[model samples]
Target: MMYRNPAILTRLALLVPLGLVTGAPAAAQEAVSVEIVPGAVSLAVGEEVTLTARVLDAEGNAVDAQVLFFPSFADGRSGSARQSIDVDRATGRIRAVKGGEFLISAIVATARNLRGEAMVSVAFPPVDRIDVTPLGGSTYVGVATRHRATLLDTAEDERDGEIRWSTSDGGVATVDRFGILTAHAPGSVVLRAEAEGISADVAYEIRENPAARLTDEILWRQKEQFSDGVGYSWIDSLKEMAEGEIGDGQLARAAARFPTNTPLTKEAYLYRSIFASHFPGEPAVRCAPEGPSIACSTPAAIAWDPAFAGMADPSGRAVQGVHAHSY
Candidate 1:
C-alpha cells in the first residue's frame, strides 16, 4: 500500500531560459569581508597616515560602499580622521587618526538590491608638538647676537604667540630688541626657552675672537702711537712703556712694539697698568717687570705719577735698563 512505484510515475524537468532549455543559471550569494592593507606603526601625534578599505562581491567584481576609519582605542584622548567619502569608492584611499588600533568600517546600502560592510584595524604612533629654532648662528665677541625662541603646537599656534627666553652667559651675551645676543669673548652659551615656566635649552658655541689678536705689522699699518699715559687711544705699540723702561731688555717686546721717547715710555707703562685695572679692554692684567726701572734711577726721570697706583715695583726703587746710561 506504500508508494510502491511513486518514483516511476513521477517525472522531473529542468527549468531554463527558453534558448538554453537543457541548463539553468546559479543564484547570487553574499561576499562581505574587511581587510586593512599595509601596517601602521608609530606616528607623530599630529602627523598623517594613509588608510584604505576594500569591498568585493562573491563573483570577484569590485563592490562600492561608504568607507571610514577611526582609532579603536583613543584612550579618552581627542583625535579625528578625515571624513568618509566615495573616494575610497573611486581610489580606495583615506587618512586615519593619531593613536591606538583603528577600527575601519565601511557601510553600503542599496534600495533592496545589496548591502556591504567592512572593518580594518591599525595602530597610530604618538607625536611631539613643540618646536624651537635660533637665528644668525654665528657671532663675534663684544658684539650683540640676536635670537628668536619659539614654542609651537605643531598642530596650531597660528597666532605666533609670545615665547620666553633666557641665557647661561647673559653677561658675555645679552638678548635685546628681538632676542638678539651681543657676544663678549670666545666662549659657549645657551638659550633656554620657556612657556608658562616649562623650558628647554639649545647650545650656542662662540668662537675665539679673531680681531682681538695683537700683531706688530697690523699695528704699524694703523700708524697707532702711544698717548704717553695721558689718554687711551689706538696705537702701534708702547709709546708709553718704551720710554719708561728705556733699553730694559726684559721689556724688549713692548719696547720694540712702541720704541718711544723717554717721558712717553715711562708714562706709557703707567698708562698700561691703569688701563688694565680700570677698563676691561686689554686682555692681559699687567706687563711691567718686578724690578726698578732705569727711568727711576736715571736723570730722565718720568713725571712719576702716583696716579698709576700699581705701575712700579713693590719696593718703590727706581733703576734703569741699558738706556739708563744716557741719563
Candidate 2:
C-alpha cells in the first residue's frame, strides 16, 4: 500500500524541477508535478522496497516519460558513490545496503522538468547478546547431550538465527550444526555457537566411561576371534551382562580390573572373572581323573595333543581333582 504525507506535499509545491523557469513562457508550457508515492518508508538493512513516482500534467492526467531515481544520505552525501543504496535506474526499485536514513528523488527531464523526493529510514537489528543453554556440564565418553543457543536483539526480542557450532578440541568432543555435542574422550573443551558476528561459549567436560571402555575391549577381543585366534565368544555375552543384566556394583568391580595399557591379558582376566563369578563351579573345563590325580586339558592344549594334560603343581604334587583352562 502506498502512503503520502500532507506536509511533504506542501514542501513539494515550492521546490520546482531544475532548469524549469517560472516565467510566463514556462507557465504557458504544460506544468508537470511529480508525486512520490509512499512519501515515507521504513525497512531493515539489506532489504528492498519499491517506490513509485506518478507524473501528472496540469489537468492531473498521467504522463509517461523517462524517470531517473537518485539516492542520497540525509547529510547530503551521494548514496550511489558511497554504495549505500542500489537503484535500478530503469525502475525506481531501491535496495538499502546499510542502516541509515536516506532521501530518494525521482526526477524527470523533457521540454518541462519535474522532480519529487521522499524519505527512507533503513534500520539494522543489532544482536545485543547471545546465550547458550546448559552453560557448563559434564558428560561421559560416548555420550551425547543437546545444547541450545539464543540470540537477543537490541529490542530485547529473541530471534532464532542460523548458528554454527564448534569445539575447541575436536578430539575431546564434537558438536554438530544443531548443537548436539558428542563426547569422544575424557577431557574438557570449549563449545562455541556463532551466528552473524555474535558468539557464545560454554565449557564442556567428558569423563571416562567404564562401561564404554569395557564394551570397546570386548569388541576388540571379538574381532580377534577369527582364523586360528583364541575364541572369545564369552566376552560378547559378558558385555551384554555388564551392560544391563548384571548389577552396577558387580559390573563396576569387574570393570575396575580392566587393564589400561596391556588390554589383551587384562581383558581376558576380566572376562574370566565375570564368567566365574556368575556361574561358579560350572566345570569351565573337562578333565579325566587318573588314579589319585586328575588330568585337565584346555581347548588350546588339546589342539596340541589329545593326551596332553595341565602341568603339575609347584609342590611337584599331582594336581588332584583340579582343572584349568586358558583363554
| RMSD of each candidate relative to the true structure | 22.6, 23.8
Reference-based lDDT, each prediction: 0.45, 0.66
User: All candidates' TM-scores?
Assistant: 0.26, 0.33
Off by over 4 Å in 2: 1-40, 43-122, 213-327
Tell me the spans in candidate 1 whose CA falls farther than 4 Å from its real position.
Answer: 1-130, 135-139, 154-159, 214-327
Candidate 2 Cα deviation (angstroms), residue 311 = 55
In model 2, the worst 10-residue window by lDDT is 285-294
* Candidate 1 structure quality by residue, lDDT tens digits, 12-120: 2222334334454644544465444544434433444455545566666555555444333323334443331112433345443323333334334332233222333
Candidate 2 lDDT, 1-327, residue by residue in tens: 889998987666656555343444544435378888899999886789888988778898777776778788877753252376777765889887766678888888663347888899878568878899989788889988899899987756576689999999999999998899999999999999999899999997789987865665576442221221333344445445545654555544543543231112223345456555765553541231121111223334434533334431111112322222232
Instruction: Give the Å error, residue 46, model 1.
Output: 11
Please give the range of 10 consecutive residues that has the lowest summed lDDT in model 1.
318-327
Candidate 1 Cα RMSD after full superposition onto the native fold (Å): 22.6
